[model samples]
Target chain A: MPYMDKRNAARLVNDYADMIMRIGLMYLKQTYDAEDICQEVFIKLMSAELTFEDREHEKAWIIRTTINTCKDRKKLAFYRYWSGEPKEELVSGDDFTGNDLLEEIKKLAKWQRVAIYLYYYEEYSTAEIAMLTGRTKSSVQKDLSRGRKFLKNILESEYGKDYGFEKGGADYAE
Target chain B: MQNREKIKKAFSGVHFSEMEKSLMTDRISEASLFAKERTGKNNMKMKRWQRVAMIVAGVLVLGGTVGAAAGTDMIRSWSNSFSDFKTAGKISQKASELGMNSFPDEIAGFEYSGGNTVHNTGEDEAGNSTGDWDELEAEYKNEDGKSIYISQSPVVEGKDDQQHTDEVVIDGTTVLYDCDEYLFLPPDMEGKTDQKLLDREASDDHFFISYGSDEPETKFFKNASFVIGDIRYLIFSYDEVSEDELISVVRELIQK
Candidate 1:
């Protein structure tokens, strides 16, 4: 018997499709590649013979797999050969193309972009982000701090000196 | 925080349409079904191979000449095995433990990044494992983000699988050059590729070719493989570096 039947697969897709898409976009910065990652992740979920302890466990598995798949896709020789040149426009979606904050986020390094997205958009803690990304907690904390500072400087400079971040956010050792 | 809300709102606007999601669901279902069938078939094939291997082993034991032939074949087959590593140090360590030549820290303008090792245990198509041999690889990257992959393995005994486009004699070693083509078919078009286009060979220079109505996209990469001493080395460039540059890189490795 198949591990995941069509109905179960459909349900999983429905539940996590948007989150997977957004994560893919943050890592890959391409709508087409992100869409491809979504399908690939679902296919993997359908074939894997894995049992989750709870909803959070399953969700964490999906998120980690999505990030790993994006990294693998980037490592592929053909992907590097063809899409090696950075595109002027990171994403094709009108929603992302016009967003000032996302534009600044895209300018950050790949790791920083992913860390910032998970910390802010997905509301994941730095420790959780580190576990999901297969990195040290301290490394994840550093990425979040540096990424946040970079975004703050750019946003404040462009918007206004009054454009400030909310005080008393997640505490970091640094 | 206001920043968190703004980030969430920005991302919420980006998502697949209902139609796209439905299409992806269908594709996943079909792929899983195909994979299940393939797994069943592979299991049956493995059982048959095991039975055949038992008979072969019995004959080899009775013949009394198995040791010499098996040892030679074991060394020859390690060129085909492959395993990935997270860092170049791991690859170098494996090579040192196996008494194989170590890869350089930097080649041409690319610095050492990460690589893999190839291992062969004299396993044939029927899946019998015996003896052991290993190969090493090192990946490099330049300032421009271009990649150069170099792998060294035991010299293969038979003809190569890829069709080589050119050959050059570098210091008594024959190096063969070829372009590797990979096709990316969108999920919606799974198993729908046109037979003719699918079989068509990729051109050397063309990076992207769009087939008007639901066809797979093609990407080509250039590489050079050659045998030096008892090791075969392959150099692959991800960018559009010229064939001469590839040969020059190989010449540099030979000098080292």
Candidate 2:
């Protein structure tokens, strides 16, 4: 029998498609690439036979696979060459547009964008972000800090010093 | 934090439409069917002549051998090998040169895109050219941009490892049908057993499967192989095309 039936696949898509697409966009910065990564992750999920201990374990697996797939896609020679051009022309079809903070986040380095997205948006700890991204805790901490500081500076310059940009409540240590 | 809320709000804009989600779900289900078909299959065997022919082709493509003993003349003669052609006239000329009867220009709705021919020479232990072989690979594309790849070579009698699930008689020739699953391992995981590879595929880090094959965008495929007279032909369709369509294409090739 097939590992994942249509009903099961539809359930997975309903549960994880949004998260996968968001993570893919944070790393890839393109809607089409994010869509491709989302589809690829679910396809891999269907073929996988590993049983998860809980819902968190399955979510972690999907997040990590999406990140790795995005990294692999960026490593391709075609993407490397394609990304070297002007950013304005490159992200013309990007979905995350018209938001000042999102534009600044998109301008950050790929690692910084990933760290920021996972830390703030997903509410993952620094250690958890490091685990998902295959980086050291200290490295992820640095990325988070640097990314946060960069976004804060942009916000402060745009909307005065009263705009609140503070440390998150998530535990950072392993 | 307000930053968290804003970040979530911004990222939330990036998501698939309902139609895309439904389409993707169907694709996943289809892929599952392919995987189920691949279960409980023995390793596909490579013929000795095919092995030698591939090694020669690999060496030639690499420009020269990197390591191994010197004074190895693996290739003695090659004619019009590794040449790409788009037209049927070119394919027929190459097939005739290889002493083959005929090759199809189009199959089903897919027109012949392009193909390459390879002529390989094998050497005996004494460094003398012993035998020569020829093989060709062709690609066809339909109006929907889907493709079918066909590979042809002379049939060599050897231990066949493919477990044919079904067979059909076309023009008195029995064609074997098999669903093949290829796990494209990372460079570090090469030469591992199939079970180990499957375990890795089932693991959380299963991104290695995407590293190979751009057309299908996946690792596994459904294929049909058959021997007609002295030549063996293998057809691969990367898209979710029907098995009957593939068989019909094979029938066209044999009849041609």
CA-only RMSD, every prediction: 13.4, 15.9
Off by over 4 Å in 1: A1-3, A81-98, A161-163, A166-174, B33-256
- Writing each residue's lDDT as its tens digit, candidate 1 over B1-256 gives 3566777666666676776667656645543332223221122112112222222222100000111113222111111111355566777777777666777777787788766553333433232334444556566877888766686666544323333578888788788776544454565554566666544523222222222213555545566777666666778664667788788788888777
Best-fitting candidate, measured by TM-score?
A: 2
For model 2, residues B1-256, the per-residue Cα lDDT tens digits are 4566777766665566776666666545533332223222222211112122323332212011111122322322222222366676787788788776555777889888776675444343344444556667676888998777677777653344334657899889888765444443333333443675557644422122321122332333556777777777877664666788889888888787
lDDT string for model 1 (A91-167, tens) is 33555423667778777877888897788777788889989999999998888778877877887888774334534
Show model 2 residue runs off by greater than 4 Å. A1-3, A80-98, A161-163, A166-174, B30-148, B151-225, B228-232, B236-256
Docking class of 2: incorrect
Assess every candidate by TM-score. 0.47, 0.51
On the 0 to 100 scale, the lDDT of residue B42 in model 2 is 28
| Predicted complexes: DockQ each | 0.20, 0.18
After aligning candidate 1 to the native by TM-score, how far in Å is the CA of A168 from where it should be? Answer: 2.5
Worst 10 residues of 1 chain B by lDDT: B59-68
Q: lDDT tens string, model 2, A12-107?
A: 888888788667667886555555566557645643446878889988998998988778776754453233212332233344432556777877
